[model samples]
Target: MISFGKILFFPILFLLSLIYRILFFLDRSFKKKRTLPSSVTISVGNFSVGGTGKTPFTLHLSKLLHSNFPSIPILILSRGYGSSGTGTRRVSENSSASEVGDEPLLLKRNLPFAEVYVGSNRYNSYLQFRSESRIPNDQKVFTLLDDGFQHHALNRDLDLVLLDCTKLSKAEFVLPLGLLRESYSSISRANFLIASKFSEEWEDLLSKWVRKYKPSQTLKFKFSPEKLIPLSPGASEVSLKDLSGRSIFGFAGLGNPDSFYSSLKDQNPSQLKTKSYPDHYSYTKEDLTHISEKSSDQDYIICTEKDGVKITSLIEMDQNFSKWFYLRLETVLENESELVNSVRSFL
Candidate 1:
């Protein structure tokens, strides 16, 4: 797979990584002050960059909090990756992906009871939500940071970091050099290290970290394929059987797009074709037109639920996308009880 392009490109990537680390060091040292939220804060973040199942895991955590402590209110904080505005904005179920980030809006829709807010200033947003939304004196409120491992501006009661075993199995290095923002040595800083996308092939690597870090808790979770619901409104439930022997056009804008395509292949589709956009990609009309042309012969078009929010919004304006559908991905934390117990003890 080595190419002359990569040979020249890798050196540039290495240089960029060096500069990034230096800036990160300076930023952390200069800030000096970290704010503590009024409510208990549990951050579900990743050491590297995007696509560590932060959104899905946040949703999972919200469910746990709601179920375990029915009286408490939960607040989710997100950076609103693709938002047009820079200031803090409250996300509602009807909010468009353009106003808030796609993930925040998706979170709002799924967790209708929870409050989800997006802004660059997480600490400010956290304070604003707390000041505005008052609760009973006895109820415990929690603030969950979405993809906020490096947000040193605020402190957390528990920091759940994710290590993508799929990508790590190949190589481990810093930033542009590899996927890590820092070295594996810093893995100990996290209260819990969650092994995301866990597989038998990478169990040894996870074991190595467990031995070295000896973190308070090391849990693993798998993102399994859930039911594929039709994107078209009132389209009815569709199952895996629908894709068998049928041509499928799968597309996603995810950190690990290949993983999604692999899942698509497992359905035993007669013909499988996929298109990948960069992480947090904003789909445009031209992009849809291209996909339409590429998948003209495809029987069905499917994407991840994250991508579905944007696609679904756009599809609402057009009636020609009857073949559109989105596959839901759920997380099953292996040591769920233990992890919950650990948090419960802290609370």
Candidate 2:
């Protein structure tokens, strides 16, 4: 029998659960079925807000897919998270973070060879890309949807859900109290799980949880620091050792700022200080002035690539602020060949 104390304690949680279920039901019931013509589509997504390394995974997966199946054109689709642009738009080389959002802009900058498009409506976005580009019908195309786990309107061949090891222990309530977009049980919808950034304890917790509600496969991986790349154009790349013993001030406008700071910490800087802004935050002149002021004493002001995308455009890169760099993160997926093969089989 249910205890009265338990019932009273969980009243708010129960109400939130009820609301989530209703929204879930409504989503499933009214979501319009979307279509794409003869293109292999894979979605990389997370259940929580935005901290998971979806962009890196998507980039790595695209490279893998191209390596496995040469001659297939890859198109990246995103909702343009914080961009002000409306409707379906292709991100260009010169597009600002405000025009195409940070992720899409970063994607374009990183993978200049691939096409990146953004639309609130995934189906419409694909259509726009298809119509504007007009690639030959004989060409093989594979589309990767970024942050697409919950964007269920569009059809996808496989869904690669990234489970943040950091969030494994957080309270599982939806929204207002917890970070989950849906209940942990919604993980069953995931075709494959990439358990990322876990400690030994977190790994153990994840393993027990997965055994209780196992999906197809749960692969473990870490987000390793690749290199320190200059945010300024035409600048050469530098190794972690290049900046050793330097005073570094780190800042990020990210869903998980601590994770970025920790990555920066791994490099063993002589002095490390950090500032965090809200996720997808657009920087103002005042904010930049404050960051510059705060970082004045440091030898370098470092940030994640996403923050760099937005920051570099707004702030002039004169001598006063030439000490900035963005840390480029790479997806160091475990069992790379096996994971590729697993995804290939699905393809």
Candidate 3:
């Protein structure tokens, strides 16, 4: 039974949402007329707020494209949600999570060859790139837009939408009430649908859902993390085997903390202790102190690559907390040929 508060609150929310939808429709129509850069833009985003595995998928796609066209210049554009910068800036090896956001920093660390840019306005960033001489036109330039499914202002050549299998069951209500960013009908905008974190059971259910709800023409791809790479301070390389038999304290501030925790639990020593925080959470000294106090006996504190980037500056400030490390995860596409073909067809 619905409570009186919920019954009353829902009606107000419904009315506000109706107003929002009308405004969104008008914004989308007006924004559609803006011209995009000449470079091919491929957006990898999700329908829900979080836990759709967008980062790993973006990394996977970047690696695939880089391998196929070695000389081509690929640029990644992101809004840098938790980053410090007010305007657009190019992400480099020296750029920290505070400077360029966690995801962009993670991308730069993983794919050193690709140029990463962070800005509130992605279209403006693309335009800036087009004017820059550093990024040559002779090199086949492809723009990989991060978290841009709803960013309709910039025209994307290919729109890849990620769906979290777990969230599908709980997608009855719209934002705040439920996780969906838009209505189910928004699937019409995507050129391809990626059922991320797919397992045998989830795959079957996802296929059934797609058959019933999505267009048959929308291509589907399944993806999961291939392996985990360790993220150590001032270290270029560290293997999972190197840290075996050591007691670990795992922590991260990401959309889906469970995935990272699970990955570490599977890979780390059986005696690993785990801790989690809210997405894009900025860590304070007290938080770190609490972690240290809890895991004082532990040998090392492990975290996700994104979280590691944010904590690097903190670690650098104090010498006593330099033992922390991060593990990087990469997406392994289930259907390589189909995924490549879909992208190539768009090109």
Tens-digit lDDT string for candidate 1 (57-136):
78888988888887778899999987786698889888889889889988998998799989998888877777777654
Tens digit of per-residue lDDT, candidate 3, span 57-152? 888889999887676678999999888888989888788777788888888988888888899888888778767746555445788989988887
Minimum summed lDDT over a 10-residue window in model 2 is located at 1-10
Q: Quantify all predictions' global Cα lDDT against the true fold.
A: 0.81, 0.79, 0.74
Query: What is the C-alpha lDDT profile of model 2 across 1-347, one tens digit per residue?
Result: 23465456577766776788789769967988676776777888887887877777777777777787776778999989889999888898789899789989988887866899988877777777777878876555788989888886888887788888877665555663456787767778777888877557687788877987787777776777888878666667778887678889999888877778887787788999988888889988788789889888898888888888887777665645667788987776777677667656644
Whole-structure CA lDDT of model 2 = 0.79
Order of the predicted models by lDDT, top scorer first: 1, 2, 3
**Residue 190, model 1, lDDT:** 85
Instruction: Choose the strongest candidate by lDDT.
Output: 1
Ranking by TM-score: 1, 2, 3
Segments of candidate 2 deviating more than 4 angstroms = 1-14, 198-201, 233-236, 342-347
In model 1, where do residues sit more than 4 Å from their true spots?
Answer: 1-6, 9-15, 136-139, 316-318
Residue 130 of model 2 has an lDDT of: 72
Distance from true position, residue 106, model 1, in Å? 1.3
